[model samples]
Target: MSEAFEQYERKYCELSANLSKKCTSASLLDGEQKKQKLSEIKSGIDEAESMIRKMDLEARSLQPNVKAVLLAKLREYKSDLNNLKSGIKQITSNSLNAAARDELLESGMADTMTVSADQRSRLMASTEKLNKSSDRIRQGRKAMLETEELGVSLLQDLHQQRQSLLHADDTLHGVDDNLGRSRRIMTNMSRRMNRNKCMIGSIIVVLIVAISLILYFKLSK
Candidate 1:
């Protein structure tokens, strides 16, 4: 595993330890302070939970024994996180109930109001519809964002490919220019070679004619 993963694991462990300590000490505080402490601990547990999950994913590349140990730790962390969340929910429920009761007593209205079954059913149905519509809207927005990102990435890749092609074309042009110059030099050398061959042939013919004339004159004398 990477050092970053190890650091995240260590941070999660430290946060879990701090959360445990905070939970133990929170009961000693007064109402508002206890709620505040619990909130802080809940935030820490949430952060730790995220880190633990990330570590769990990162641990897949580790040895089997190490992965098993990390998985066990992840499961323990998850259980603890669930417990912390349940505790927070209970605390919030209790606080709300306490506040409502106090307010009713202070207002001299101890009676509670109850909704009819039909009304409750209708309210639930309306809330469900609203939630479904919200979820659809959220999903649509997420898809649009993903598509936009993909398009941008594709455009960037295309731009890079175009630049590479242009570079290749320029290089080919340079090669063509060099080849043309080489061909011209070869043509010039061929012409010069032909001229030199002709001059050498003429010199040999003149020397042969001079030797023949001298031999004929000596024989005749």
Candidate 2:
């Protein structure tokens, strides 16, 4: 019975020592290992608490001499486990606060520059005005390009119309030359007809005079 109590006491002391070491070295562990170590520590704490309760009941049922020794060992075990738990709580709390501070520093939240509300408002208004000006400039450039395209199209149309007008003027000059040649041809034809008519009339008059001379001679004979 004494040997069993000694073994139980030694086992409890060994677990207490391991729990202390785990808590103290928690800061050196990486994220996943730290979490796993914490889980194991929590399980150890629960088992220790349960064992202390069982030992208390067992100690009460034992004889006075054995009960006294068992109670003393049980008290020591419970005290050591409680102290280990307190240390673990303090370490975890400190670690959490340190991590929070580091996160704030890394995100620039802790070292952010303070700006006055008036200055912020003025900056926003200036940005909006710049955007509006840029939009207007873009629209103006687009309108100018469209005007240039329309001017080019108008110039091209004027050039085409001028070419058509030039071609029409050339055609009209050719028609005028043809009309003048036709008029001269008609004038020459009329002059030739008048000369033929005068020649025929002269011949008829000569024949009539000759015939009258002949008729007079015959009558006298």
Candidate 3:
């Protein structure tokens, strides 16, 4: 009976140690997974920041208010992402240690229970933060997309307006040139008509004078 009790105790200890190690490893895996998720969220935020920067530059060169709004949005997203990062760090660092593991393990199969509970709590908190970050990033992306579309439409409208104005200007200039040419031709014709009238008046005056003198001579004879 004594020997049997000793064997049972040894087996239980061995099982406890194995279970505790497995739980620790599981916790470690959960931490790594959360880190990966955090990295993915950070990547998304970075991409959004880059897009916002590009939009801002375009808006600066093309539109003022648009640039300002986009820049402001970028700042807001960056701040939110920083908060998410802080939360992730806190959750990941609350890891269970060896003493806690051994005590929980020896407490009759509660080792797995305690470790699982801790892992679940940490995972849940980190996952929630990561999800929130993702949601914000998605929202930001959507807003940027809308902004880009609006910008493109505005640019197209401006281009069309410029083209129309240029065309109208060219037509007006052509008409003005034509009117100037017509005015010059009319002026030249008027000057020629005045000279011809003067010449005809001089010839008529000389003929009248000659006829009157002939009549006078005949009468005197």
Residues 8-118 of candidate 2 have per-residue lDDT tens digits of 555665666566667655644535676788788888888777667766776777777557655655655665666667655654554565467557767876642432343
Considering every candidate listed, which one attains the maximal TM-score?
Answer: 3
List TM-score per model, in order.
0.43, 0.44, 0.61
Taking every candidate in turn, the Cα RMSD to the unseen true structure, in Å, is: 13.3, 40.6, 18.1
TM-score, structure 2 vs. true: 0.44
Residue-level lDDT of model 3, residues 166-208, one tens digit each, is 9999999999999999999999999999999999999999999
RMSD of 2: 40.6
* lDDT tens digits, residue span 55-110, model 1: 87777777664565456545655665565555456445545655676577679776
Query: What local lDDT does model 1 show for residue 102?
Result: 58
Model 2: how far residue 101 lies from native, Å? 1.6
Report the lDDT of model 2 for residue 46: 82
Ranking of all predicted structures according to TM-score, beginning with the best and ending with the worst: 3, 2, 1
What is the lDDT of every predicted structure here? 0.64, 0.64, 0.56
Count of backbone clashes, every candidate in sequence: 0, 0, 0
Winning model by lDDT: 1
Where does the lowest 10-residue lDDT sum fall in candidate 1? 113-122
Model 1 misplaced stretches (Cα beyond 4 Å): 1-124
